[model samples]
Structures are given as structure tokens and as C-alpha cells.
Target: MVNLWTSSEHALSYLAIADAIPHRTEGEGVLLNQVPKTVRRILDLGTGNGRLLSLLKIDRPQAECIGLDFSPTMLAAAQEQFMGDDSVHVQVHDLDQPLPDLGQFDAVVSSFAIHHLAHERKRSLYAEIFACLAPGGVFCNLEHVASPTERLHQQFREAMGIGDRPDDPSNKLLDVETQLQWLRAIGFEDVDCYWKWLELALLIGRKPTV
Candidate 1:
């Protein structure tokens, strides 16, 4: 099935209500706190309008960041937001496919993206992300993950004001434990779910310096 994110309408619709997501800022804040200020180059995958990258820039202002997304609407928005700021590079990239040669980064991040891919691709992407990071580099993914049980999943949806509505078929949610295991298997150190609120979670891992 084609991902809805590729559609301009679908992309725009999400952006329209993006700010209303409850506790999102809190999670973003925790994610930011984990990233070191000394980072020089950062890579943001599936970057929607450069929102998270914009937050990261406040602390790591000297860091050159690449905000990548395949959707034209998202890319346009990100481009418009980061325009005239040479420190931030907005580029096109599809998460469903192998990442292009974008060079190594001191930190890599993604927010509310990646769940659209198949389960297997998710693990492979973690491996690819590990390869793209410099030694001691951090990978922080603020994600929409699967709940332990279907009942809990329903409860989470209700809490998010998604009561009784047909779920987004685009989401291929995976459990947090499995994703953390994948990170460890991929040779990342300090793999863990650093913060979580029901279905929303922040999974972080670091590339070993040695």
C-alpha cells in the first residue's frame, strides 16, 4: 500500500493539527535534553517542516543540520522554514528505501515518523542509522509505537481523541522492546526507550566510540 504521507493533502492535514498533540512538547523537550550541545552535524530523517530540527538548533546553533523528507509538501514547508539559513540543509529522502549517501553525523533524529514502514524495514533502518553516525554519535527517535495489548492500544487511541475511528492503516507499529533489541543487535550501545507516554515513545541509542 502507498504511504499516505506522500499525498500533499494528507501531509498538509497533519501539519494543520500538529501542534495540538498532547504532551508532544514534553517529549520533544526530553529528546532535546539528551542530545549533547557539542554535536557538529545532525541528520533529521522524515523531517516534517523542520520542526524538531528547529528546536535542536536553539541549543546547537553552530551545528549544521540536514532535514530530509520525501513528501513535496513537507520538503517545501521545511525549505521555506529553513530558507536563507545555510546551517540547515533541506533535502529529499524516502524512508521506505535505503538511505542515500548523506555522510556521517554527530546525531540523527526522527519525530513521529518511521512507523509507516514494514516491520523488517524498521530494523534495517536502525542498522543504516547506526552506520551513518560517527563514533559516540546519538540516535534519537521520537516514535509512535505499538502498545502491549489491543485493549491498551484502543485506550491509547481514545486518549489521543481518536475514539471509535478507523485507525490509520499507514501505521505499522512495533513494540518498544523489539526495537530496542534491534538497536542492540545492530551494535549500538546504551539502547533504551528513554521516555514514553502510552503509544508515543522516544527510543535512543549511541554508537560506540571504540
Candidate 2:
């Protein structure tokens, strides 16, 4: 069965510590800079509490935004965050399944969410994201990628304040190089790992206009 993040405690814990994750704001800033100001519509996958989408909306106040996540508790929190705000739409959808018919978007973004998917599913989901984006659109994934070695992995765990604990079974970490290659092969232009610190990295790619 899919390890959906349904438990309120787990969801809340993520939110509580989400901001304290080191180098996160820097990565988020890079992602924000990459998005074109002309973008009129945006989609966010695995939008826990709609954080990334909410940030995007702050700058692009007139842009239409849609946030998708699978956790019921997360959905509730996101809904509450966007309450009385019409510019953003929040929905619950498992990333383990195919994306819905939400139409096209000028940009798609995710933060520390896609790594939970299986390797094959991650590639397939990138393809789906490509198909859903308008030409010239961009995809920004602030992901938790795998470290180079067991030692590096341990170091990463230390950085995250996790030690002597097993890696989250829910994590299916992929390396930055492989994911960037997949992005390029899937027709994403200018694909690269924009920023990284330990296991946390900002992977960016743009849909070709041609």
C-alpha cells in the first residue's frame, strides 16, 4: 500500500520543522528567481500546506494557482492557509497516480516532496509534468536527493538532526545527475542542479518553446 501521509502528527511535524531545514530559503529563492514573472498560471505538486504556492502567490498575486497533495491533514492545513483567498486552489491528489486533467500551467513547482516516489514513477511523473506545461514553461523541484556514499548519507542525516536512525522508508532518493539527465532526455531545456547543500538540492528545467 502507498505510504500516504495521513497521520496528523506526522504532517504537523513536517510543518513544524519545515522552515528550519538548512539552506531551504536559499533554494526557494533560486526557484523563485527562475520562474518568469509573465507566468499567469501555476501548479504545485505535493503542496504540503501550500507553502511554495503561497510564496509564489505573494509575488504573482494575479496568477491562478493550483496546489495538489495526497494527505488529508495536509489538505486541511493548506485549505486553512488559503482560506478567503480566491487566487489559489487546493486539492488532494496522490502523486503515486497520474496527474489529473487540470489543464496547462505556465509553471509547475514542488518542494521536498517528489523524492517519496519510486524511481520509475519519478521519471514517469516528470514526463507527465512536461506534458502538462505550456511551451516555455518551467519546472522547479526543490528535492531531497541521495548522497554520493554511505558516509555522505550519514553526514546528511546529521545535517538534518537525524542520527543513529534509519532513513525514512518512505524516501526513494535519486541522485541529482540522474534526475537532471532524465529531465534533459524528456525534452526539458537548460536542465541543471541549480543549488545543493548536502542532500537538499534545487533541480530546475524548462520546457522548450520550440
Which model scores highest in TM-score?
1
Alpha carbon deviation, residue 75, candidate 1 (Å): 0.7
Q: Give me the runs in candidate 2 sitting further than 4 Å from their true place.
A: 1-4
* Model 2 quality (TM-score): 0.97
Residue 147 lDDT, candidate 2, scale 0-100: 91
TM-score of each predicted structure versus truth:
0.98, 0.97
Tell me the deviation in Å of residue 129 in model 2: 0.5
Residue clash pairs of candidate 1? none
Write model 2 residue lDDT over 1-210, tens digit each, in one string: 346477787788889999899889999999999998779999999999988988888789889999999888899989999999998899979898999999999999999999999999999999999999999999999999999899999998988898878767778899999999999999999999999999999999999998
